[model samples]
Target: MYRLHKFLWELRRNPELAERFRSDPDQTMRDYGLNEEEIRAIKGKEFRKLYQAGANPYILLFGAVHMGVPRQEYYERMRSQS
Candidate 1:
């Protein structure tokens, strides 16, 4: 979870890292040492799963936004999981 949070923080603050992630998410996630569950949640855009896994909602939303997911879509995805 710490690794996931760190990666999310970096993804939010570091434009270069975000671009690198956008280019090759699998590789970027692997490089971040994220486990399969974390990688899957992010790659699959499963925001609710991430939240359930204890990610801070604000960080998750910011990271999702950096990845081009709209705010409404993020909320929709989160609600759909309920």
Candidate 2:
């Protein structure tokens, strides 16, 4: 989660950097400790599960970080209603 936070921070500060990383999924998986075969599995990994894993949660990062959506939006959209 901490790593995800840091990544989100980076994405927010410089989304171009995020795009560069995402551009090469190969390097990204390798950096995430996936072996060749494991990388292949990652290629098949569902995008939603990736968001759930939260290690390098790109979906949230993409919206909250890359899109520069105000924190208020996150609050309104994500705050627990219960």
Candidate 3:
């Protein structure tokens, strides 16, 4: 049920919304161990960066925690940080 790639790509498309999450992306970036700078850096890149094979660990974790992944999965991924 997780269209993980599509959802992440959408987040790539919409950066302002991404900024809203920036203050605390860590709870989402938990398993991947990404920090705010890397999260902001990845989002700050041009659109082409989304298409690159270099999947941002932040984006991957963000989608899994915020958008496409299941609510249960979200809670599981975020519980400790919560």
Candidate 4:
């Protein structure tokens, strides 16, 4: 959601933050002030949930890439949920 952009912005702007997030998402998300649901969705790699929760598409894509999830996998997950 609005918060997702904040994460994305941080990731884009701060290489150290990105590295920290890549290394420890749970802690980083918590430190970054994401709510429980947002942290859950991110930890679970539930892109569809994140998307439905209002994560920007571009930011979501960035998150997916950061998580090393393939674009095809993201689409499949979205389609399965749909």
* Candidate that scores best on lDDT: 1
Per-prediction TM-score, please?
0.94, 0.36, 0.25, 0.79
Per-residue lDDT tens digits for candidate 1, residues 1-82, read 8888889889989999999999999889989999988899899999998998899999999989998899999999999975
lDDT of 3 by residue, 23-57 (tens): 65544443244555444533443223332445555
Q: Candidate 4: which stretches are off by over 4 Å? A: none
Cα displacement (angstroms), candidate 2, residue 64, comes to 4.9
Q: What is the lDDT of candidate 1?
A: 0.92
lDDT of each: 0.92, 0.49, 0.46, 0.78
Clashing pairs in 3: none
The alpha-carbon deviation from the true structure for residue 58 of candidate 4, after best TM-score superposition, in angstroms, is 1.8
Per-model clash counts, in order, read: 0, 0, 0, 0
Pairs of colliding residues, candidate 4: none
> How well does model 4 score by local distance difference test?
0.78
Instruction: Give lDDT tens digits, candidate 4, residues 1-82.
Output: 6666788667766788888988998889888788888888777778887788777878887767766688898888867764
Q: What are the per-residue Cα lDDT tens digits for candidate 2 across 1-82?
A: 4433454456556657557556886785456455565345334433244344554544453535353455555445445322
Error of 4 at 17 (Å): 2.0
